[model samples]
Target: MQTITSARMAAIDTNCEYLGIKRLQLMENAGAAVASAVKERISSGKVVIIAGRGNNGGDAFVAARHLGGYDVTVILIGKKEDLKTPEALHNWNVLEKTSIPLVEFTNSTFFDPSILKNAKVIIDGIFGTGVRGRIHEPESTIIDLINGSGAFVLSVDVPSGFDPDGGEFDKAVHAGLTLTFHKMKTGFLSQNAQQYTGEIRVVDIGIPIEAEFYVGPGDIQPFLKRPAISHKGDAGRILVIGGGPYSGAPALSALSALRAGADIVTVAAPKNVSDIIASYSPNLIVKKLTGEILVEDDIPIISRLIEKHDVVVMGMGLGNADETLLAIEKIVPLCTKAVIDADALSPQLVPFLDKNMILTPHAGEMKRLSGNDVPDEQKERIEFIKSFAQKNEVTVLLKGAIDLISDWLEVRANRTGNAGMTVGGTGDVLAGLTGALFARCKSPLEAAACGAFINGAAGDMAFKEFGYGLLATDIIDYIPAVMKA
Candidate 1:
């Protein structure tokens, strides 16, 4: 079971050409799978297939044709003539010959609840992986109607109006089941998709196995699995530094690292907070640093401590100061695998970065590091981050509405995490998770990507129970659940 982003899936579609498979054949298989699943679930239900203008709608069209014997109505949600794909148009032409009632909606006024009042099952094909931005007015209204219909809504591919890679959705269809073809879309497992998607079943459409090698979840699972004969030291050791004014931040990171499968976690903080951190978790080994504020003189002791751990998580709650920045600049160069995050991120520390380091920065942190604001548009931000990561020779996990991870070798997006994760300490947890992964992963880039995905997914699971009131501790509690999923 592999999960891929919408853009990566699109790349796979193109790669299929090399295998002598046309896009139409894939769509046909996808539609057949959806139809088969529907038939198996509800044989006598009146199926309402709500299709859009994209290839996803084409898949629904194919399902409509296969299930034409049943009471099925095909509702096209866009200008029928504007469909871009030849395969989609072909399916549309085939639908015209069927007796299944077909309706078109060019504008918001066309959304009529009466059309779907008799539907026992609704097939959502309104939008697919490529959809971004807020769903338009009529579409939003239509989605709301389908959600409130009390009918079993089966989504074709991914739920329409949801970002397949990652990010919050303005509007999306709530599905009882999501029938995804070939592989699971990354969005289906992301934070935003949880509300809209349920019981995601990946249907094999016979995509070549070799095609998977080109793009997929690139080696992130090693960190999730435990070794059979692993001892405490074998699981990986993590050292977390930072904690003066904001003591809980480093503690949160240390706890998350432990939850993420790190066997040994050590926290090196000011003496005032060392006992406070140790009291939270018995697993933590606290080292009290004798300093009012971290300075360049602390680098020698930090360098010695780095030798005792596999990876170091730094910068959480470390107040931004010239002295702190100087200490980070000196310490980061000495450490092999380090997560430079929070207040530790500064232009002064860039020269110390190497491929072994992971820089976890939010939008504001990224702006400070790069001296340019990340644009609201996801694609633009992804490109900018990729360029920046490649230039710096370090993996950059740019935390935003959609987390984008980039190293010189590859770029990936993690669309996990709910609105509830906006609270403080979550970022600290993310840094801790990354540090733990870095201990097991082959490279810093792989650790950073997996860390973001797992951290955000854990947040999504926490949101199920806690909803809007979720805290960072809730996310840590759900870490195992996300890994099991």
Candidate 2:
């Protein structure tokens, strides 16, 4: 049996749309599935859908329209005008035309408790799988009413108030049957969720298998969590150790980190190019070192700085000198999470490489790291890279026409980039993007895969704007647009 976490499910849906599947069609299919599940449980009775003003409510509205044999009443948990998504609001408008009773959840006292008490089947669509934390307000009071009633509950997806990823919650719905879509969610199999989830049934809404296998704009789902009350440095505080012999490499990296949504980016560079790198962007926090290139002496201060940031991105234009390699060996291992690229991909740095580190290497750097020649053929290259990653127990992102990201056991191939991405500084942008994403993503492999996809997709977008004239900076310019899409 195949399964998907909430993040993966969302990514798959995004890919579905990217592949030309309409969002409204998926919603209709989801609603039809919910209605069928409800009908299977109850032959005929009064049905009450407790809906929130979101996609979840849209699903309920679709279900209400399909349940023609039952006496349906929609208890919208919020104002009808409050629906934020177009699909949800569209469904809400459609339900308004029908004769089914439409009630709004204005306050605790406004809704009739008898509606829930008299319901033979109550659809718990107050929240979808994305919801987290404590159940509050009218919904909190309504949750008590629903639980208090003898109604046969049919929850849309996981029960409302349940964290699909599995966690502690203030309150959660106890459903007799949970009609999950496409695949099972994050917490579906956990022992803590079994009682709350009830008899779980996976519904096929026709999301293609290719959606699951391919990397798309949806892969960035994990990086998009923005809480209303989030504090500073909540997104990511990235420390970049590079610069010197060449300045723009680290500058490109820091800017890439910033563009990829890292809250703060600090570049620690040599004296020769620290000012130059700093001048590239006022957004970058520059830490000036004593020498022209990385030396053994810089390790102590770099180690101290590493403690302050969430992820460290090392070796973008720090020339491949002997002292620089020594610096990389000393600095990379002390850091918690890192992206080792550019001049930092020396053989000596391999000992410091771990699962927490993402190594972005082209053919030459890959050959140097593994002492194995990379075959020109795609299949052989994948096998070689996969084997090397497994043997080293490190994440390897092989940069090429088709990027191959592997974390020993699992692998993902990203074909989003075009031939125009052969420009000089693009790899640095990719490394920075990966580090920025690495700070937020739970898995290093996921971050690397998303990094490759976004960088390549942005490159493709740039290619569309400017043919063979595509520059590395152009990819950087397109990062936000690609991510937003």
Candidate 3:
């Protein structure tokens, strides 16, 4: 039941000695659990266990020992001489005594399809949590072969060739079932991981409960729970103030806020655009403001609207104007918590920094906020952004190849999006999502981190079907998928 990140798993491994379990015993338990799962699934099928040179392969070897009565074969991706860990070598020695067929992958010998033609189950052990970079040529070829074979593939620990924590791999094994050890890795929950791992099963290998206590529970619980007796107003109210020429943008933001668990959503737009926004979503309560663009005259009315809502989302599709700048200055100071994005992130409004506020700015908007003319380099930008957020006592989410979220305490990097999110209005959706969470969250920093992670994950999910053609609306559609119970 423990939901842990990859770093937490590594910490468990490093602190195993203190938990009173040897590494060898943990590996044994892992293999036995996997073997039990295999035996339950296919009683007498021809089993082909793909073995690497790591501990993951060692688990496969142990499973082969238990499956000796059945028709089983082990395929080692590398030569026997290249075996790394002591546990892996010990398992290999024990497996060699059995009559089960063994094959070493090499340039001279071609992988015979006949070996796996009748195999009812295929075990993937090519790589595991320790895998880094892209899958090399031969491994990529192996993954392709496994995928094309149409066999029921079961991956041990994790699907081979996938990164344990972050980053995308060139190729990975598409497993019908994945048997992960101890705790679930962060990659197991990602949209990209779903492409390779069909169904995930976590095996508890007798790791101490203290192992989980070390990392503490993840911060996602607050977003997952629902109160049974709560009403619409109790959940939280969100006010979205943006929409003029780009009418669809504000609607997208408002809907996303509702989708991200906001109970009541109100869109404040010009009279001409309010009708269009209201027509798009019946859940939205649109308030028709007097001006086409948010002006100074609209500030008093906007402040009154902000009082009813728990949080406010500003700056999506807000056209740049002197009146807009003045309106933002007055409105920002009045709201308890606000999410500022798009044209509302101008330098003129930088002085009103509230720790309760979150700013969702893309690279260009970030440059405007920081008044920096430098080119985009991730490390340099993150450092500068952290300094900016700390100086202002606000949370800033800098959107780019990898999203960097910062406040005074810490900087968390989110690597969960595809290039498909470059479409317009996605930022508006993100701003709305942040605003929704901001209403319920204890701090602005948590809201920002959770919002970025959830939004990027939704975008990643949308990218799977739509690929590069993913629209902003597609991201909003998949928000429920990412935020599933």
Candidate 4:
């Protein structure tokens, strides 16, 4: 009964592989499910598979292999060389070695509508959930042909051409049945979706629970991609407010923010530590605030800086002085979005937990703010984190051996980190990484979840060579590698 967005489904698929479930194995299961669905409808006939050059097509190829004795013919909507995924290409290679009739339509001119006239059942695997916007070329022509053919049409994943996220389309296949995978697509719940989807069956592709529940490489994919024509600050412009008691923490956060793909990172530190923080990196833009520590007088200048930045990553090493805490109270309300961490995680900030803030807290800090101990048991901890996020209406990134991220509605646990990450400044790195992601991400929970995953995964990579000697700076150095992965 649960529904997932196509984007989330793709994330889950990638996570499944991260957990050792290969794409080929999932394709086999999906195809077998499609083949079984066809058999249930009608045993034997001239079954025509209309497939695209992606995973949807791969599923059709697997189904064709499974329907061995039946008269199955596969019509690939694009050239074999154009198959998009390795799994799709692998299945196509398998079909090429078989005796099944195969047809390839590389262009619009190659389509033959009359070919569908005699098809007892048409498997529409042209465009699963990935497609959006206007229908193109052979796929457009083929959709019309399949609709007019009057065959028992079974669409794979989703009705081809239907926007599985929005439930709108330029044109789509009118399937008699839609064999969706893993879960019902969110788009199918729309009022008009049933016209194209018909009877829908949610197919299980054997995705592990860890894939959906845990943060992995899949969770960060959307954030890593950039538009070709993006401007300088399109990634993120972060304003880090820390330092005073210690300079290293804020500098680490600022450096990690840049390493995590933030375009510009500025550090606002007390005049004494400002030079020291700036000396750590030539890249950082340091704004020196007056006095030994943050005070109410610095609020005006900090407010101006906050307006210029996309997100405020605050409280890395700004100690718990009363004047400094009062300054934090004023500055936090000014931030449109913030990643609150370290000494900044105070009960005074609770009233301002307006869902725009991401709170990253270790066990002691979390207990300080929530007045409750973080349970050792994972289930109880998850519920505790979720409940806190819901009640506060804020995103919570609880840092521990198992990082827990929650935005009330959904809770994701990240298991990418290790014992080596207990290093002092790793939490600062995570706070900065989270600030970078939160600036661009639509969901605070997603940004926190992916940030935790990236921070820990990078730590894991650093641990490979550095072992227990892994430093927080080492984690920052490997951020791009983790993103690339």
Q: In TM-score terms, which candidate is top?
A: 4
**Which 10 successive residues of model 3 have the least lDDT summed?**
212-221
For residues 35-98, could you state the per-residue lDDT of candidate 2 as single tens digits?
9988888899899999988788889899999999798999888787888689998998998899
How much lDDT does each candidate structure score? 0.83, 0.87, 0.82, 0.92
For candidate 2, the per-residue lDDT at 414 reads 86
- List model 4 lDDT by residue over 97-170, tens digit each: 99999998887445767778788899999987889899988688789889999899999999999989865579
Candidate 1, residue 46: Cα displacement in angstroms equals 45
- In angstroms, give how far residue 470 of model 2 lies from its true place: 2.4
RMSD in order of candidates: 17.4, 3.6, 16.8, 1.4
Per-residue lDDT tens digits for candidate 1, residues 1-485, read 46787755775676576457788999999999889888988868688998888899999999999895689999888767978688999999998887888887878445768878878899998888888897886678888899999899999988887777777768788898998877778767666566688888888887886454322233344554675777877878999998876789999999999988888999888777778889998988888877755777777777789999999999988898787778888888788889989989998988888888899999999989999988889769878988898898989998976788889566777767878899988999999998988898677776887788788878988898999999999999988776662
Full ranking by lDDT: 4, 2, 1, 3
Candidate 4 lDDT score at position 305? 96
| Candidate 3 lDDT by residue in tens digits, 24-95 | 788788888878888889879788888898888888888888885788889988888878888888888887
**Steric collisions counted per model:** 1, 0, 0, 0
Model 2: how far residue 103 lies from native, Å:
3.9
Worst 10 residues of 4 by lDDT: 106-115
312 Cα displacement, candidate 1 (Å) = 0.9
TM-score of each: 0.58, 0.84, 0.58, 0.97
Q: Which wins on TM-score, candidate 3 or candidate 4?
A: 4
How does residue 217 of candidate 1 score in lDDT?
32
Between candidates 2 and 3, the one scoring higher on lDDT is: 2
